[model samples]
Target: MIGEARRALPLRTATSRLVVVVRAASAADYEPVLDVLVDAGIRSLELTLTTPGTIERLGSLIERYGADADVGVGTVVDREQLSRTIDAGAHYIVTPITSAELIEQSVTHGVPIIPGGLTPTELFASWSRGASAVKVFPASQVTPGYVKDLRGPFPGIQVVPSGGIDIDGAAEWLEAGAAAVSVGGPLLGDALRGGDLRALRARALRFVTACSQAPRAHRSAVPTRP
Candidate 1:
C-alpha cells in the first residue's frame, strides 16, 4: 500500500489543504479526539508519534477511520520510528526534521513522507530527496510573508505550515503559497482538554470554512478523505 501512496499523494494534497494535528493527551483521549474531527469533515489527519501509544494506536485508527480520512503519522524522527509507523498502516509519514535515513526508509517503502524543516537549506534538501512535502515548524513565530519569501528562492517546493495557526490564519498561509496549513493547539484548543464535542465540531467547521474560502488556486479544500 505504501508503494501506491506517492502516486496518489498529489491528488490527496490538492484536496486536503487543512491537515489537523492530532496529539493525544492520554491514551483515552485518542479515539474521541479523532471521532469529532473526522465527523466534522476533516480529511487530512496527522497522528503525532510523540504521543505515547500512537504507533500502537495507528493501526486501529487506520482500521476504523482509514476509509474516511488520510491517517498519517507525525513527529517521526528516525528510521526505527518510521518503520514502526509504516508497519502500523500509516498512509503518510511526517518528521520534525529532515533525515535522509528516515526519508530513504519511507521512499524505499514507497510511502509518502513530509519532513519538517525551517531553513531554506533543509527544505530544499528534503525536496531533492523526494519528500512528499516539507512541514514548516513554529509557523506561528513567523508571518505568512515568510513563506512567500521562502518561495522566492525555492518556488517549486511544497510547504505546509504546522504549529500555532488558528482558524483565521489558515487562509493567510494558503494565500501566501503554502501548499496546505497544518493546525493544532490553536485549532484543537480545548477539545483535547475535555471540551464539549459540539463546540469542537463548531470550531472544526470554522477552520474548514476558512480553508474552503481560500483561493482555489492555492489548493482545493475537499471535504472528503480518500
Candidate 2:
C-alpha cells in the first residue's frame, strides 16, 4: 500500500506554503487545539504520533472537516510510524531530526516531510534529500538572526522554527527568513489541563494574525567589486 502511494504521488508537487504543526498530548486535546487553529484561519494541522489515538483522531478530523482543513501527523521516528501515518491519510510528515530513510519514504509516499535540524550541515543535508522544509528544533537557543545568516549562503532553504516559538517571537523569525514557525505551548497553553477553549481559540487567532502581519526582511543589493 505504501509502495503504491509512492509510485502514484510525490511530495515536491505538494502545496507551497508554510504549515502550522500542533503537537498535543491527547486525543481530547486535539479537538480544542484544532478548533483554535481553524478559527485562526490556519488550514494546516499536525498531530504528533505520540498523542494518544492520533490515528483514530485524525480519521475523525478528516471525516468532520473534509477538505476544509489539511491534516498530518508529526514526531514520526521510523518506518513503521511512517507507514501508519501515511495510511491514516496525513497530508504531510514532520520529524524532529533528519533521517534519510524517512525522507525517502515520505517522498515515495508523496507526503511532504519537515525534518528537524540544528546546524548548517544537518539543514543542508535535509534539504539535499528533498525535505519540504527543515525545522530548527529548540529554536529559542538560536535567534532569528541566525536564520538570516543561514539564508545568506543557502538562499532557498525553507526554515521552520519549531521549539520555543511563540506569538512574541514569531514575527522576528519570519522577518529573518523562516518559511513558518510552529508554536506549541503558547498557543495551546495550560488549556490542555482543563483551561477554557474560548481563550485558547482567541490566543490562536492573535498568534496567526501576528504572523500574517510580520514584515519580510529586505534583501540587500550586492556590490560588484572590480
Candidate 3:
C-alpha cells in the first residue's frame, strides 16, 4: 500500500510504552546493552545510524532480538539509508528531519516512518504526508505542555517525543498525550562504554515504570507496529 492508503501509527509494545534509543560509539556496543534493556522489559528499540556500523550489523541484531523487541533504524535522512534499513529488515524507520521524499519512499516500501519536526507545520506536513508518527525532537527544548498544546490544533496526530528526554520526562510527556517517548543518554547512561549491564537494566526498568504509571490520553486508534 501507498501513503494515501495507509494510516499513521504510534510506537507501542507490550513490554513498555517507551522507545529505547541506543546510540553507542560502536555497533559492538549494541548487543550487550540491548540484552540488558530487553531483559529489563524494554521492547521497542531504535538503533540510530549515527552509531558506526549500525546498518551493517542491523540484520544480525534483528536476527538476535527481533522476536523479543521491535528493532528499528533511526536517523535515516535519505532514500539510500532508508532502503538499506529496510533491506536490513528494520521493523520501522525514524528520521531526524521531515522529508517528503523519504516519507514517500518509506510508505511505498511499507515501513512505518516517524519523521522529526518541532513546529506545527512541520509536524502536520509529516503526519499528512504519511509519516507513521511525528517525532517531536529536541524535546528538552520544549516542555510537555508543548505537546499538550499541539493536541489542541491537531487532535488526531500521534507524536513521539524524542531527544534529551529523561526518565521523569518520559512520564511527563506521556501524560501530556505523547504516543510514546524516545529516550537515549539518560536511559543508557555509560552502558555503551562498558559501564555496567546491571545498572543499565535498572535504568531501563525505571524508565519503563515511569512510563507505565503515566496517564494515557484518548488518542486516535493506530497500530503499534508496521
Candidate 4:
C-alpha cells in the first residue's frame, strides 16, 4: 500500500509538519489550490469530500501531483466514503470523529485514518483502535497548554491539532506537542473562494517555515510498573 508506507506518527508523514486542509466550492479548485501549496514546498494536502465532485478531483490529483504531494481526503464520516477514498488512491483519510467502523475499514483497505476527538477518553479510544493519529478538533476549545497536559497521560499517542488554527498558532501547537497542525480558513482565507493563488502560495510558505522551526515530539511512552 503506497499510503501505508507512512511513518508511525501520521504528521511525520508531512515534510512541512503541516497538513493544509482545503475546502472549496467545487472540484475546479483542486488543481490550482494544490499546485500552489505543493509548489510552495508544502506536500501534505487534505481535500475535504464536502466539495462537489470530490471523487473525480481526488483521482485526478492523485494521478497528477500524487508523486510529489501527499494528497488525501478529509471529512470522511462513513464507511462508504472510506471505500471511495481508498479506491480513488487517497494517500490518507481523515474523519471529524473517531469511528471504529471507519478505522476498521481503513485497516481493511490498507489506508491510514486520522480520527477526530475532544475529550481524553475519546482521543484514547481512537488511538487504541489503530488510528494513524488523533486530531484534537475544534482546537479553539483548548489551548496548546492542553496538548502539553495530554502528554502527561498519553505520552506515546500521536496527535494533530486541527480546526481554527491560525497563522501564528502552528508553532504553538508544535512546540506544545502536536505532531503536525491542520489549517484551513486561517491559511487559505478568500483564496479558497477563488481569490488569489500567489497569496495562498505565500501563506503556505509561511506555515511551512513556521512548522519547520518548532521542535517535534518523539514517539515514546511512559513505561508501566510491573
Candidate 5:
C-alpha cells in the first residue's frame, strides 16, 4: 500500500519536524500566512479544505513555492476532496477523522495522510490502516501527561497534537512525546482578521523556537528480571 501511494502522490519532505495548520477565509490570505510560516523555518503547512478556492490556492502554492515548501490540504473528509487535493498538487492530505476510502485514495495518489483521533482505539485504528501519523485533536482536552501515557503503549506511533495548542502547549506536547505540533489560531491569531503579517511572523517564530528548546523526555527502561 505504502509503495503504491509513493508512486502516485510522492511524499513531501519529512514534515515530522514542524507542521503548521492555517485556516484562512480567502485565497488572498494564503501567501502572506504561508510566508510567515516559511520565514519561521516551518516547512510543513496545511491549508484547510474549507478555505475559499482551496484547490486553486493549493495549486498556486505548489507552483510558486515548489520544493521550498511542503503544502497540503487539511480538514479533508471524503474521497472527492482527497482527489481534488491531489490534483491541485498537495504534497499530503490531512483529515480531522479517519476515512478508509480517503486514506486509500491518498495512497493511490502517493501523498501522505494524517488522520485525527482522540482515543487510544481510534489512534490505533488509524495507525493500523497506514496513516503516516495520527493527529490528537482537541489536544488541550488531554494534558501532556496523557500524551506521555499514550506513548508508553504506542511508542512508535507519530502523534501530532492539533487543537488548542499554543507555543507553550506545543513545547509541552513535544516533551510529552508528540512527533510534532500543529498550531492554528495561536499562531495565526488575529493576523488573518487584522492583516498583521508582522505579528503572524513573530508568533510563528516563537512556536519554532519553543519547539526547538523543548526537552524530549528519556523513555524509562523496562526492568530486567534477575
Candidate 6:
C-alpha cells in the first residue's frame, strides 16, 4: 500500500509536501485558483465535492493539470463519489470520515485513500486497513504535540493534518511528523471570490517556501516495547 501510495502521491517531494485544498462556491473557480497555486509550486491539489459541478468537471481538470499537478477529489462520503473519482482518474481520494468500505474499495481500485479521523482509534483503524495515510481533521483543536503523542503508539502511522492549517502551522505540523499538511482558507483566502491573483500567488509561494524550509520529521519509527 505504501508503495502504491508513493506512486499515487509523492508526499516527500518539495512540491507536494503541502497539499492545497481547493474548496470554492463553484467548480468554475478552480482553474484560475489552481493556476496560481501550481504556478507557485504546489503539486498536490484537492478539489472537494462541496463545490457545485465538481464531479462533472473533474475529468477535464485532471486532463488539463494531470502532468503538472496531482488532481484529486476530497470531501468524499459515499461509494458513489468514490467510484466517480476513480473513474475520473483522480490521483487520490480524501474522505472527511473513516469508512472501512471506502478504504477497501479504494485499495481494490488502486487509488490511495486518505481518510480523516480525530481520535487515535479512528486514525489507527484507517491506517491498519490499508489507507495510504490518515488525515487528522480539525487540526486546530490539537497542537502538533498530538501528532507526536500518536507516534508513541502507532509508530508507523503517517498523518496529514487538515482544517485550519495556516502558513506557519503548515511547517509546524511537518516538523511535528505530519506526512503532509492540507491547507484551504489560509492558502486560498478570497482568491476564489474574485480576489487578486497576484496576492494569491505570493501567499502560495510563501507556503511553498515555508514547507521546504521546515525541518522534516524522521519518517522511520521503531516501536518501543512496553
- Candidate lDDT values, in order: 0.78, 0.72, 0.83, 0.79, 0.73, 0.84
Per-residue accuracy of model 1 over 1-226 as CA lDDT, tens digit each: 3222332343454476888888876655788878888888888888887788888777887888888888888888777888888898898888899887787788778787888888888887876677777888878777888776776676556778888888778898888777788998877878888888898888888888888788743433312213
How well is each residue in 9-104 modelled by candidate 4, as lDDT tens digits?
333354567998888889787787888888888778888989998877778788887777788799999888888889989888889997888887
Candidate number with greatest TM-score: 3
Q: lDDT score, residue 194, model 4?
A: 77
Tell me the TM-score of model 5.
0.86
Worst 10 residues of 2 by lDDT: 7-16
lDDT of 2 at 179: 69
Model 1 segments more than 4 A misplaced: 1-10, 217-226
Cand. 3 Cα-lDDT: 0.83
**How many residue pairs clash in all the candidates, one count each?**
0, 1, 0, 0, 4, 0
Using lDDT as the yardstick, the better of models 1 and 4 is: 4
Would you list the clashing residue pairs of candidate 1? none
Residue 215, model 6, lDDT: 88
lDDT-best of 3 and 6: 6
How do all models score by TM-score? 0.89, 0.84, 0.93, 0.90, 0.86, 0.92
Model with the higher TM-score, candidate 5 or 6: 6
Candidate 5 steric clashes: 4
Query: How well is each residue in 1-226 modelled by candidate 2, as lDDT tens digits?
Result: 2222222112221221235566556787767667666766666676788888887777778776546566767899999989988888887788988898898888776677888889999987877777767889879889998887787787666778888777878888887867677777877787677788888878877876787788766544322111
Error of 1 at 98 (Å): 1.4
lDDT per residue, candidate 5, 112-132, as tens digits? Answer: 788888999888777666676
Compared with the true structure, what per-residue lDDT tens digits does model 3 show for residues 30-124? 88889888888888999999999999999999999988889988999988999999999998899999899999888887778889999999998
Model 3 misplaced stretches (Cα beyond 4 Å) = 1-3, 7-15, 221-226
lDDT of 2: 0.72
